[model samples]
Target chain A: MHDIGVRETIRFLGLTFNIETLKMTWLAMGIVILIACLATRNLKVVPQGWQNFVEMIILWLHDQIDAMMGRRGRMLAPFIVGLFMFLLASNLIGLVPLMASPTNDLNTTLGLALLVVVMVHCLGLYFKGGHYIAHFFQPTPVFVVINMIEEIAKPITLAFRLFGNILAGEILIIVLLKLMPIWMPIPSVCWLAFSIFISCVQAVIFTMLSMAYLANAVKEDHAE
Target chain B: MIVLIEINATILAQILNFLILVVLLRAVAYKPVARLLQQRSDKIKGDLDKAEADRKAAEQTLEQYKVQLADAHKKAQDIVDKANVTARQEHDAAVAETRKEIERMKATAQAEIENERNRAFDEMKSQIVSLSLAAAGKVVMKNIDTKENDKLVNDFISKLDKNMFADLR
Candidate 1:
């Protein structure tokens, strides 16, 4: 597990980059794109194979998001669906030999969580105008500090929740590899199975939480 | 752990990566798949609606046939009833006409019998009067003439016909 905390980084246009994480992200993106293209290739009224499978995922996300946000949620369906697909891909990619999850890195998860938080704020403002801002100081002005901290904690928790789980799973696998060297196969398999389940669960959790936040932002508040 | 969670420019690149991914995936994946699902949902809904409409149409046609069948049944009954009424009227008229013809024939036969009986009575009276006149003439040839005898016979025959007709009445 010596290389657990070590990173493969590079310089491109004078900016430092995490090459390992970026490359994994690109791979996940490519997989997402390829799956989408293959599913959409035939474009039949009666769907079969990949078309049916992909449509099921897309529509499931559509329904889940639409339920949270109503018709307005339809606009966010593509992003939410794409995010889920990407996260699922990123999470599962770590299972491959010589591969790591992009989500296992802090940068990728933090970036995603920040994006969700920022989107929530932007959508809140767009939908509720001044009320979105005023809601922070709700019930009394004294609550603003708590509310602000809560808002800040949202992205942090979101990022760490995903990053922590995936990184721990990867670390444990490495530890098992280091500790159990020859007879590591059984522990590896067991952990791999657990990690796969955890991967799916984490992806769902992140997507659902993001959807809730977005819905909370865009939905109209009832006037008393 | 600090190194593992360190912040870097890679976050910016990753953000850019996710954004590009979202855009590209939306363009290539979500939109087309969503549209296909929508189309399939629409097709299913349309087929269901068409089936419902067809069922309703079939029910409507069945109702119409039922009404038409009822009308035909009523019409056939009316024809039978009308035929019965016409047949009764024709039968009654035929009976009345037959009764009238029978009555007329009886009256004609009575008249003809009365005429023949009157003529026979007149002839008998004439023969009786002639015989009596002859006897009287025989007696009177010694005493009267033939002209008196014929007049006597004719007057007697007329009287006999009038007497016989009165008695019969």
Candidate 2:
């Protein structure tokens, strides 16, 4: 099996760099950006071809954001859509020959989770003010410790859930390939299809969780 | 065949890449497409409003035309009715005037015929007196006195009753 971590680092100017994940991440970013540019270029009032496809994807993402985040979804739609696109591209890249999925690395998923957690807290403070921190001690003071622990667990679980699933899928595919190397391609093919399904699901889950976090953070606190 | 788990600089690089992608995609794609959609919807709304206004104006004009046509029809009917009444009155007056003229002409003709018959009766009476006087003169012959005879005849005629002439006729 390939390394579970982003193991390939290139030393440059006395500094170490994790080159494999970085390169793959950059490749994913480039492909997404290129498609975005092509889709937006020469946009007609009447859309056709690539524009139609891109618009459909954007409209679906918008609907997801609206459903999950309610009235406040409009402000965050672009970021959420970008997150989904990036995750989807990164996850699917592993299906191609000689490419590793960047999301398989703990560092990458953790970084994304940290970003979400920080944004959530910041938005909570902005929208709810003191009530944001006061939610932990609701009903009685005894629940404060539990609430704090739950809050800390949020990022860890978010990161590990996505990382574990994608990494396991890739590992399973590798093992299946090795087990049936010649003449019998059914097992490997089936595993590949399953891996693809997992990748798509993980990307959707990450995006949905992120939106949910945002919605929870920014919502108005109604005292009961 | 081995796997390593570590935290390193790749996380920061990935974060940076993700942020850049978000900004780039937002600039090149999301904003423009959204603006185009809004503009198209606004244009469609304006066109619909204009079409509605045009339809309303056409309906108003048609209504005015209908009213005018109705008025013209009523006016024409009134004129025909007035002409018929005037013609009937004129015919009635002409007939009454012709009847009055015929009555007046008949009265004038009857008066003229009565005057002519009276004049003819007077002429016949004068002729009879002259002829009777001549016959009396011839019967008396050379011995007869004309003046005396004439006086006698005049006296006799004067004393005679007019009713005796009616018996003679």
Candidate 3:
């Protein structure tokens, strides 16, 4: 934990980075990729064993994306699915002792939030063009400032929401682990299960919200 | 005493970090994983398509079998109908043959009866002729001479008349 808190640690050839989060993130990413590759290696029309299960998950994600984004969801399926799997894996990796979730750090969450915001704006501009900017000035000119403030608040809210939830869960588990020695591991176990559930939920929620924002931005002519 | 300094991440630093992570993830993780998923989906779709094709072919084969069965049934019905017609024609021919045989027997029997009646009539005619001649001869012999012949003839005529009258009565 002390080693994790200490920032700007460099070891080889002056490549200074956050040690714990970066390492876990890489490891999680590698695991997801490896699993995907291994599952799809001998692709058959009638999937057997692990490939069949993995295909079900992908198809399920496809349905969720379609539900959230409608026809355009198919286009965004790969990106959102990839993001969900990556985040879920990273979050679950934190459950292991001595491993920190990169998402628990503000930097990672902020980065992801900003990426979503930028993509949202880009899609809005691409789809709606000049009309997209006009959405902020709706009802009255005064509302434009409010809309702008809300847009600015989005990334801050997104980052803190994820970071705070994960960090708090981790801290609570740590505390519980220390407070009760005999039955102490029970709470940790429960917390671990809960954290896994919460991580999956958060990933889905985050992707769903991002898709909604994009969908809202991309609506062409809302005259009424 | 070591003082803990809080280092704020600059926008440039954050952006650089973000780009690096994105690039790394894209290269090492996201692309490969997504590609694998795409391949799997393609495989599944291929399998589904094959199954659908097989189903359609099976349906077509079933239809063919049904059509063939129907044709076979129709042919069987036609054969049965032909057999019934042949049986009916043969029955009618046999009845006509029986009727012709009865008509020939009736005609033959009528001809035999007519011939028997003609022969009986002929025999009766001959007998009557013979009897008449004998009566004439007896009258002539009993008279013997010239005057008595006339008288005998008159008597004979009178007697014949009486007899005729009696027969008539």
Choose the strongest candidate by lDDT: 1
Candidate 3 regions off by >4 Å?
A: A3-5, A11-16, A219-224, B1-169
lDDT per residue as tens, model 2, A136-168: 798788999998898899889999998898878
Model 1, span B95-136: residue lDDT tens = 999999999999999999989888877876786677667766
Write down the C-alpha DockQ for each prediction. Answer: 0.39, 0.36, 0.07
- Model 3 chain B weakest 10-residue run by lDDT: B1-10
Can you tell me the CAPRI class of model 1?
acceptable
Reference-based TM-score, model 1? 0.74
- Output the lDDT of residue A177, model 2: 71
Writing each residue's lDDT as its tens digit, candidate 1 over A12-90 gives 8988888889989999999988888888888899878888788778778877876789788898888898899999999
Would you list the rank order by DockQ, best first? 1, 2, 3
lDDT of 1 at B11: 97
What DockQ does candidate 3 have relative to the true complex? 0.07
Encode model 3's per-residue lDDT on B25-113: one tens digit a residue.
45554454457667767888999999999999999999999999999999999999999999999999999999999999999999988
Stretches off by above 4 angstroms in model 2 are: A1-6, A13-15, A222-224, B1-3, B47-62, B79-169
- Two-chain complex of model 2, DockQ on C-alpha atoms against the true structure: 0.36
**What shift in Å separates residue A210 of candidate 1 from its native position after superposition?**
1.0
Cα error, candidate 2, residue A38 (Å): 1.9
